[model samples]
Target: MIPFRFLHAADLHLDSRFAGLAHLPAAVRSYLRESTFAALGRLICLAIKENVDFVVISGDIYDVSDASLQGQLRFQEALKELGEQGIPVFLIHGNHDPLDGPRLVAEMPEHVTVFGGDAPGYATAHRRRDGQEVAIVSGISYPTAKVTANTAVTFSRKPGSELFHIALLHGNVDGDLQHETYSPCSRKDLIGQGFDYWALGHIHKRSILYEKPYIVYPGNIQGRSVKETGPKGCYVVDVRENGEAALQFHELDIVRWQVTELSIDGMEHEAQWVEAVERRIEDIREADPHLMTVVRFRLTGRGNVHRLLAEKGAAADLLSELQRREALRAERKEYPGLVWTEGFAVESGLAVDRSRLLQEDSFLGEMLRLAEKGEGEGSREELEDIISSAIAPLMENRELRRLLSQVSEEEKLDWLRGAAELGITLLSGLEGAGEAEGGFRDKPDGGRYDED
Candidate 1:
């Protein structure tokens, strides 16, 4: 076998609207809306720059099954450029863009080969230099959006082919819980097949499930949400003549998503909060000076700032001020890149001395003890029941019911933490009011009214 190389990418998710982020500024929103397309452009540029023999997109060419005309036109134009460069592209349709879905009126370039859903399709890639056949590409597309059957069993390596074989698939491996269990198949099922490389999709986090005959998922080219953070990109696989393949990852995302934390442990005033947050934003911009960043700030730890944050609209004011500052900088072109604040979360508590309170045999102590107990492993089931009961009415709404079903246990625990902190702060405030009025004193159980 001769040495060859190819670009392996998946989950382009073009035309992603970046849902759940509708509150962003018009300029930032527009940038996010076109981020996926910009990622596609970067991918095309990388392919041409590397001068690879071919390109393999495992699945999910569009964000939705019924892809938009604009997305299709842009995609076709990019592929046409690849065709002009004499580079072939082999791709498959995942659940997001299945074969049965509606599509644009335009046709794909001749150099592109889209695998069908009837069976595992096959193609041969020829090196443009000498026109020598290098490798065999095989894949299958989803017939519809919801595929419940195990599609991996249907694939078999070609008979008597000495060429390097790459298999493309878009399905859950062994029922990966992170993603929907569509076209479920086990890693054993894939490994048993004699294919040289497995170009996978569906799950949008990159992973190399196996090596030797490499099984890989290049993740999505662009992150559509904050949950999918960090650098998003593709892989360039260089196959040595001896069949040992080397992989190089490249970042293609234009706009980045991040969740940053700011500790208010020693903070004494509101101005300090503003300065600290601004510093964190500057650090993010400096780290990636070229890319635009959308960050969610989380303020943590017990401090005086926590009491300020407890005030109605305090957190909102802080977030607004930060946003206004950044917007002004952007307008004046003060910074080389933009760092937009997505939202702020004040997960802090009142700066009370917990040790003294915990020692007292009063209502405040009991409350603190119970809050600690709630964080233990044994309390999870009870906490779940309590939280579910509290939110039962909200869950009764059809949309909210469906949305709540998708909320993870970890996120629910965060809500519990925030609630506990708020309860503590409110109780502490009442204690302060009682002392200042000289109307009450701490009793064994709780506060008591003083005798005249």
Candidate 2:
């Protein structure tokens, strides 16, 4: 009936280069580069503050490609600090930091217990104040980078073990659209294993897969790209004397990647458009005066702004004005700064009504139908092929390749939607539907790259 606490975290991705964003400002890049380590520092600080019995790191401690000594040394120092505080660290190596990973060059501190790569490792932590056994955490590290098996099914409660049981692992349970199926297990497989808690890694977004005997994914400590938005961090868990468990999340991401949609339906002039966008930018900077923020935007809804946004070079001009404004504010020290737009997409539908036009068998109606056919025609793959062929010329750029590497399908779809909007605008102009608005949106999918 002993009560205890532990911090569960995963996917440190230490020293990982912020992908899909090779063109951010130097100051922003510098902050992003150190964000993963900072997240670790925050985790360590939280551990000390909570006086947790131990800490559990599911996996992916560091990106294997970034074999920087700074990351290694920083990791060593942080664990050493926890050791000095008499707190134990239990961790497993995920695919990104497999036992054979090239980036893992440093030794762990004495207080850290890393589950072996060959098999699942076991450890028991004793409460610092009372010296009573709080729990036994079982973990399995990846022997190599790609392990595909139900690793969870391989575990069983220790022989007559009389303590709380926790399991640590790095794998895909069932399947994930956002990630590869590595070391795959099943939810039922994990739950039936009789482990009191499962601290998982690999997947970057947090999810509570089960209750009672808790199965949780703590997600990554820091978001590396636009695909990873919102809060990112670790979980603090308390196992009460009656074995009732509770979890609370702490934010560790120093830079938050976010996307917001703005409606430009009411604006009639260019000045109004600029004012509306500048106001939103102000709101973003005010969101957190303390931390840096990278944002992407989706300008949605049916409005004249959609036609303007479809014009060439319009998106860049908009972003430039925003950047200039940011610089002015920062120079005058009028605002506590640290915000920039990574990219944006214009998904606005055409402002003109086509319901009556579609009643006639006209070219405009056919164009509109074809443009939206992907929504129902099962022609998405076909359209993707056409789009890919058209944009292949731009893909030759190395920077473009790297930028798209971390982009998710969901984000990519935003660009495709913008393309459809542009098509609608072009067709409207051709049909003598008056002057099209010059407003434009930019997407990372070759929409508009920031030149500044």
Candidate 3:
């Protein structure tokens, strides 16, 4: 066995649109458009700096099924850079960029090996100094966008090979419900294959499923949306003389996604609210320092600030102020120091005593009692029925149906809770019904994007 090193990355998602972010400023939107490309460049630079023997990308080199010309060109250019450095790249196409889909004509460099879809293809990495065989890479690409068959089972190790074996696959393992269950397979299906490492893709969040043989998912090179948060990057695996592999993660994302909750419990004045949010933003900047962070802030806890936030245009005004401040900060810095505000979810509530209100015999008391009844009885079915009825019209509208289709059951339940809270706030006379803004209201199937 020969000692070697390689970089493992998956889910490049090149030329991502960063959709549903048109509400941001032109400067931020323009930066986001190039972030995916920047992340890819960073990955290639990392591979060169690490001086890895080879690079393996499990799947999803492009964002769409029909790979875009721009994405293919950018990917080709990056691969050429690696090829110039004498580093070989073995890549496979996942569900996002299947082989059967249309792609622009961009010839790959000699050092790049794109695995075929018919069966698992094999590529061997050799030492540049003496041409000694080091590692064997086996991978398969998706024949079409929908790969229902267990693609992992198609791979079989070369019998009695002394070189380290690495399998690159893109599929759901053990039925992870978070992503589309394409090419589904179990852990038992992957283990005991004589492979030294399993390089996987498709699920964006990184995880190490096993240790002895090193089953790893390096995740996407960039965070495409707020749902995919934290540091996004690839792994550099070092194969020692003893045939044992060691893995190290290196972040390559240019723009990071962050979700945070800020309590407005003690704040009585609007200035305090602004200062508190500013402090949180500063904390996030201090942590990331180099990368631009897109934050989804949730305002929680009971306070007088909720009363103010419930007023028309109050939250929007605050958001604008924050955006302006960050934009100015970015203008001053030579590098990316900006923390773009994606929007705020005001989950804060009034300071009224719900228990005290429940004891009264007024219309507001009856409403509170009914809310308690619904909550205590676990009226999930009833809430679902109400939500479905309210959203039925929105579903009928072809324009909004696509957006509403992503609403999860958890989100629907959250909306029901928000509706109950808003009803109580209105009935309690904390804010005038006429003054209550649509942005503050709990909209069925459209809660997260009520803000601009």
lDDT of 3 by residue, 213-246 (tens): 7888899988877678899999999999998888
Against the true structure, what is each candidate's TM-score? 0.80, 0.80, 0.80
Candidate 2 accuracy as TM-score: 0.80
**Candidate closest to the true structure, highest lDDT:** 3
Model 2 poorest 10 in a row by lDDT: 443-452
* Model 1 clashing residue pairs (backbone): none
Clashes of each: 0, 5, 0
Model 3: pairs clashing at backbone N, Cα or C within 3 Å = none
After aligning candidate 3 to the native by TM-score, how far in Å is the CA of 364 from where it should be? 13
Estimate every model's Cα lDDT from 0 to 1.
0.80, 0.75, 0.81
**TM-score between model 1 and native:** 0.80
Per-residue lDDT tens digits for candidate 1, residues 257-305, read 7778788888888888878888898899899888888787767777776
TM-score of 3: 0.80
